[model samples]
Target: MKAMIKVTLKNGVLDPQGKAIMGSLQSLGFNGYDNVRQGKYFELDIEAFSKEEAKARATDMCEQLLANTVIENYEIEIV
Candidate 1:
């Protein structure tokens, strides 16, 4: 199975990197982008007998290391 994980800063969290990217885009004449929140996307392959098992493992992976749950939120999709 393949899993796609997306981790992103929670709302109200300060994202300096996102701000910098937005600034760079503006400098290059790319306007109308007021806010940009950067996130991480991870693809993984795992051996699981069932979708439920895969989801559980993927959730554990996010809680353990893939995302900082205190300041970030994550979503996992298994395929």
Candidate 2:
């Protein structure tokens, strides 16, 4: 099974990196984008018997290490 975890800063948290990216995009003539946010994308391969198991394990991975729950939120996708 394959799982993906996307981690992003929670609302109200200052994202300097995202701001910088927005500035760079505007400067490069890539306008029409606003309030841009950046995040982490992780792809994991797991040996699971079902999609539920894969997602559950990936959720655990996010809770334990992939994401900092205090400042970040994560979503899981299983394939």
Candidate 3:
């Protein structure tokens, strides 16, 4: 089974890296770059009988390590 996880900051959290990237883009003459935000993606291969099972395990992984539950939210996709 293959599981992909995307972790992103929740709304109202400060994102310095995203801000820096946006500034850099503007400096490079990329006009009107509306906004930018940063996040993380993970791809994992595991042994599981069903897609739901894989998603459940990946959710656990997100809660435990892949994401910060308080400030970040995660979504899992089974592929």
Candidate 4:
């Protein structure tokens, strides 16, 4: 099975990197972009038998090592 995980900063979190990107874009003549946020995507190949198991394991991975739970939120999708 394949598992895809997306991790991103939670609402109200300060994202300096995102802000910097926005500034750079504006400097390059990109306009009207009010906001920008960055996130991470991870794809994993696992030996789970079913989508449910893959989802569970991926969720555990996210909680254990993939994301900083204190400041980030994650979502898991199994394929």
- Among these predictions, the greatest lDDT belongs to 1
lDDT of each: 0.95, 0.93, 0.91, 0.92
Candidate 4, 1-79: lDDT as tens digits: 8888999999999999999999999999999778698999999898988889889889899999999999999999888
Residue pairs clashing in model 1 are none
The Cα RMSD of model 2 versus the native structure comes to: 0.7
Candidate numbers, best lDDT first, in rank order:
1, 2, 4, 3
Residue 68, model 2: lDDT of: 99
| CA-only RMSD, every prediction | 0.8, 0.7, 1.0, 0.9
For model 2, how does the per-residue alpha-carbon lDDT over 29-51 read when each residue is reduced to its tens digit?
Answer: 99776998999999989999999
After best superposition, candidate 2 residue 57: deviation in angstroms?
0.7
Global Cα lDDT for candidate 1: 0.95
Tens-digit per-residue lDDT, 1-79, candidate 3: 8898999999899899999999999999898566588999999997899998888999999999999989999999998
| TM-score for each predicted model, relative to the true structure | 0.94, 0.95, 0.93, 0.93
Which parts of model 4 are misplaced by more than 4 Å? none
**What lDDT score is found at residue 30 in candidate 4?**
94
Candidate 1 clash total? Answer: 0
Q: lDDT, candidate 1, residue 8? A: 98
Candidate 1 lDDT over 8-71, as tens digits, reads 9999999999999998998899976688999999999989999889999999999999999999
TM-score of 4: 0.93
| Residue 14 displacement in candidate 2 (angstroms) | 0.9
- Model 3 scores worst on lDDT over the 10 consecutive residues at 28-37
Task: Write the number of the candidate with greater lDDT, choosing between 1 and 2.
Answer: 1
What lDDT is reached at residue 32 by model 4?
Answer: 78
* Native-referenced Cα lDDT, model 2: 0.93
